[model samples]
Target: MEFAAVLLAAGASRRLGRPKQLLRRDGETLLRRGARLALASGAARTLVVLGARAEVLRGELDGLAVEIVLNPDWQDGMAASLAAAARALAGFDGAVLVLACDQPALELAHLHALRDGAAAAGCAATEHAGALGVPALIAPALWRDATDLRGDRGFGAGLAQAPDGAVWRLRAPELELDLDTPGDVDAAIARGWLDPA
Candidate 1:
């Protein structure tokens, strides 16, 4: 269970008006929420990749026991941020649970399931019923792809390219919703997600 939570928060939230990670929901920003969830999920090392508003988000992560990696190539896309974190954990073992900062629905339980699923797969992705989900855990055998990742679109593409049947599904609701717009935030609020306004 000694895994790393590679938080991909380096995206430019051009669609969310401002940085979505900074928008407060339930008295916490999305970036903080993702970091905290990763911590609660038994992640010994939580590496958050920051781009766009890296400095602004850095203050939010203060004292959270999370490591920060600023992705200078973040503007290129989310893949750059993932590569930054993957390189940071070049020699790691166990599972790497990847997550997006804008996803408030992600919870500790979901991450645990991802870990369990990955462990079950042993050296590959744990296949599931739905599309490959994250908090998806990628075992060390797949770490090479993560580290060598380029561009955006996340490591899932590599997983997909790996020959299929390596994805694990956790049937958790947290993976269903990702708050990206003001309306999404409002919907999450109405659904009792949090006062993320």
Candidate 2:
């Protein structure tokens, strides 16, 4: 399937008390690592939505193949980032895999499974942190549903509206880890997600 990965990296990272996008480990920023993973996953294209420190974050993506999109309303919340990415891929015919930049442990295999699942089920999501969420593959038919999501809550409503058994569920334990705060970053480092730098 010729799917695209939409990486949401616009958050301000208030809890982390710093710009998590620029947070480095092993000399690579978080956003850059996420984009690299998306590209390595075999997505036909990778689109990263940037907000907050957009200019600074853009620097992280230098030499990467991913497309960069700016979301001016990112302060409104994650829904804006989703909408921006969905809009960017509007002309494309394939599914859009929405990803969060904070998942340090997300791998190429997990993304490949989501794309394959989405190709079969119209939508594919992983069961993580006790809930259904990204890394999720949204079929073209369901892209509008993602655009309709509002507020900080994000794609919950869109997922809820999926037809019975229409959403493919993949087990991904790594999805449970995210870099939401300083301690989370520390844990990720201790786990060898990245070499200490």
Query: Candidate 1 lDDT, tens digit per residue, 1-197?
Result: 56888888887777668787876667888889888888887877988989887887899998899889888998888767877888888777767877787766666767776777666654233233444545667766776676566665655666665554455556665456666777877777777675734
For model 1, the stretches where C-alpha displacement exceeds 4 angstroms are 123-129, 161-165
For model 2, the stretches where C-alpha displacement exceeds 4 angstroms are 195-197
Candidate 2 lDDT over residue span 1-197, tens digit each:
77888899999999988887776656877789889988898888899999999998898899999899999999989888988887887778887888888887777888888878877788889887657888888777777766777888666567767788788988978678887878888888898774464
Error of 2 at 65 (Å): 1.8
| Candidate 1 CA-lDDT value | 0.72
Which is the leading candidate under lDDT?
A: 2
Q: Estimated TM-score per prediction?
A: 0.86, 0.91
